[model samples]
Target: MSGANIERREIFRAIGELAYVVAKSDRGLTPAERQVFFQIAQEELDYDSWAAQSRFELLDEVIQPSIDRAYNDALHELRKYSAYLTEDIKEKVMTVLQRVAVCCEGLSANETFVLDRVRKDLQSLG
Candidate 1:
């Protein structure tokens, strides 16, 4: 892949991983949360783009490897690009993380863990 394509793919995958974590943080993904994830993946990432489509197809074709590659410690990885993403996008991501933390019947242990990590990451960006 071209350098630009690789970069975009990385961004898209990061976004996807964030969405996935948010959706699954509570250990039970809601329909609304799943829809939010799909919308973000389709709209924000422009999944129709050649590069994005290729990455999406690859993800579909090989789910486990793709997920392994996409997963990262968001608190650490996200800090590197804290200045690169728009403020709105960063806020939206944080909001999503917060929402995930509260999405379960109540806040699950995993949700609290991820939420605390996200909170620390956001605080660091400030």
Candidate 2:
């Protein structure tokens, strides 16, 4: 793949992993949260919801084996890609994460904690 395409894949995986973390944070992904997840993917990432969800499921498969380990790994990957994120993309990322944070029945502590860290990380990005 070309460098740009490779970067796109990496960023998608990183962000998709993040969305997974939020969705699964409380041990279940509710229908509302799922809607927000795919909404972001479709609008911001130009992906159909179902297709984006397939990729996200694939990522979760790779990461869900060890939740704690997966979280640290996702955080590292998120930070790594922050520098390459553009202003528009950063806005969308934050928006998507925020939507994920609050889209369920209500905001869970876990989701809030994750969102706080990610918000700070995105803010520091170039």
Candidate 3:
């Protein structure tokens, strides 16, 4: 794949993993909660193509082993590209993280873990 395609794949994969982390944070993935994750993944990451399918597939493959590890890894990947993102994109990332925190009806333990890692990762971008 081209360099840009590789980067896009990485970003989309991270978003998908984030979605999974949020959806599974409550220990169960409800349809409504899944929808929230899907919407954020699509709209925020701009993965509105067939590539989204591949990205999600990768996330499904990697996220199950350990949610916290996947989220932290994804956060590190996102931080690497922070300088290339616009202010709007950065805000969208934050929005998605917040949405994930509440995807399980409320802040569950897993969601809190993800949120804390996300907050620390984003803060380190400065």
How badly does each model clash, as a count of residue pairs? 0, 0, 0
For 1-126, candidate 1 gives per-residue lDDT tens digits of 776545445544455565556556554457666554454455444542333334433443455232224445443455655555556656655665565455446667876676676566667776
Regions of model 2 farther than 4 Å from truth: 47-52, 61-63
Candidates sorted on lDDT, descending: 2, 3, 1
Residue 111 error, candidate 2, Å = 1.0
TM-score of each: 0.52, 0.75, 0.67
Q: What is the C-alpha lDDT of each candidate?
A: 0.52, 0.67, 0.63
- Candidate 3 residue runs with Cα over 4 Å from true position: 1-5, 47-54, 61-63
Give the local distance difference test score of model 3.
0.63
Model 2 TM-score, all chains together = 0.75
True lDDT of residue 55, candidate 3: 50
Q: Please identify model 1 stretches exceeding 4 Å from their true place.
A: 1-12, 28-33, 39-61, 65-77, 101-106
Rank order by TM-score, top first? 2, 3, 1
lDDT per residue (tens digit) for residues 1-126 in model 3: 787666656665666666666666667556677556666566655643235435545566553546677677777777766655455655666677677567556888877776676666667776
Model 2 Cα lDDT, one tens digit per residue, 71-105: 56656765676666677766666776777777667
